[model samples]
Target: MASKDSIEMDQELAKRLFTEGATVVLLDVPKGTDFGIDIKSWNTGENFKGIKMIPPGFHYVHYSAVDEFGDIAPRVGFIHWFSKSEFLVKRWDPKEEELSSEPVPEEIVQRLKDNLMNLDRYLGPYPYDTWKQWQELTNRIDSTIIERCAPVCGYIRSALELENCDDKSRPRGAETSRKRKRGACLSDEQKEQELLPDLKPKAGTELRLTELPNLHYPEGSTPAEITKHSLDSSYTLDLLLSKLKQPIEIIGELQLAYVCFLAGQSLDAFEHWKLLVSLICRADSAISVRRLIYIEFLRTLEAQLALIPEEVLYDIVASNNFVYHNLRRLFANIESNSEVDARLKSEAVRMRDRISTKFVWDFSNLQEEEDDEAPVVVSLDAE
Candidate 1:
């Protein structure tokens, strides 16, 4: 079924990639250990040394240590921007059972380069099938965003890095409750003892994400103004945008959070992604003011929604989820607002229809439901 020209073009592209793409020379990794770059993953074989023919740009390299019993540890990964024909070397630490932190000597790296042909058989080709999707997901992201958002440890872990809490790090007023029913059997020492310090995440393990502004109304607002701002988050959105160097960086952050969640399995990234979505969707007035942002937001959101598993989009018991509610609100706001740019409005409508068709979600009654119920106010104040 292949045309001669098309087949020839494919061959030519493959040849170019093979000759010009980057290489990562990982050494001494266990045969059964999990190894991956970007979206593709595989168990390392006995002869596996590293990956080759990686198309130049950003890539996330991740792996999990496996035990003899076949139990796997939490996944850990780092993002790196590769250059064409660049050769990088890393070695496994047998004692630590992970990649060594020490840098490879230049002389040794040169020697490996000298013997590169002999090592070619052990290298795996990069997975090309998911490459396009990965690029779309990360198009807005770049080196600056990566440096700002990545964890200080320079890697992401699926599991939180927790450590035992010291006395100084313990919470104040953490004593055991004294209240008890009369005649209840209790240990006197247990009742008097202060609660133990809770384990906490290691300092450098946390991602340096941009902090989201509070969703509540600004200080000194009248009751009516508070209610209005609460119904629409455009004011809060402006405040958040003011902190960013460019409005487009918000999209970059959104992309970064998504890759961290999808590839690194970070729940923290998932939470951040949800917060960003909520903020963007609630900003009704922002659609007209930031038309470019809304356009990119819709495009990015559509791509992300397609990749998300169906189970995450809806809940059988709950009927609908956070994404459903927020998206419905967004569509209702865009449809009702006359001030929104025609182009942005059209894109919003197209996205709404696509989502409705794909997910079988009915947006027809969203405006009616919105009118019937009071707008949900997300208060930052604690009770």
Candidate 2:
């Protein structure tokens, strides 16, 4: 019944879809169920079949399987990278109320292909509204990082499986106990546990952030070097400045970790944050550098705090002591008026007060203020 040109255009569209677009066929997903691919959602009806014309890249598929009784299962999600013309399929199990691994037979795939025109009516296009936001969130994460951090199981779930609810509250395991019983000598694992406030091991479905190694000093560094740069003093300032100059790619990893934890509820992101704060706060550089670094640190923290979601702010405040303490130290350092540069002093005061007013936190100290002009800032080149 169609005109010749109309039929040719349809054929061309089909060819394009087959060559470039990815397909996700959800078998037996119930009518009226909530389903989402990437950032878009739909309440699927009986007419719904699946999604077509999805771009080739990493995507999140989330669904809340509904039952006839109206009870809803926990929302589940996973990350998958689609290839060109990929035909991926998943089947929903009514009994389990979850997706099962039952493979779609080859014959069924062929049948679907043959009926592609008819099925096209039921397939929805990918969501574009949130795609821009998703790009901003993932821009820094490269293929290497993705390959390193992704779960071996190929997907992540929103909720982790908790074990031994009646016993120890720690969901990670009894490894900490065994470590303590063994001895007080700290290995990397032990050090990491100490640093993290909520050091629980990730369970089912949770996206894990890439693990970052502990900070180490350069080779052949002396004891005096260690003593000179004790974490509490000015040496810490130098460390912060050096780290601030790190490449954008590495910085992107931190941003990726942050956004993932914020948006994806990844525990791995939480861990990464702990390390980042520790590195920034534990440096003990000299006085001049310390003053400069405090300004930089204040700017960085304020930016991060402003951008962080309100829901996650409480977790951040409660989890870490380093940032808070260091901030207070910065405020105290400014109040001391140790430096001769009046402009630097004024800006430091302004930064401290601005954060204090915004967060409603008293960053001031109870200890007596250091004398104004305690000493002149020494030259960096001076011996």
Tell me each candidate's TM-score.
Answer: 0.86, 0.55
Candidate 2 lDDT over 78-136, as tens digits, reads 56667887887777888877677577788888788778788878888776556666665
**lDDT of residue 134 for candidate 2:** 60
RMSD of each: 5.4, 10.9
Q: What is the lDDT, from 0 to 100, of the residue 238 in candidate 1?
A: 88
User: What stretches of model 2 exceed 4 Å from their correct place?
Assistant: 1-19, 67-72, 142-144, 162-208, 214-263, 267-309, 313-383
- At residue 114, give the lDDT of candidate 1: 96
At residue 329, candidate 1 shows an lDDT of 85
Model 1 regions more than 4 Å off = 164-199, 314-319, 370-373, 376-383
TM-score of 1: 0.86
Question: Local distance difference test, per candidate?
Answer: 0.84, 0.60
Q: Which residue pairs does candidate 1 place in steric collision?
A: none
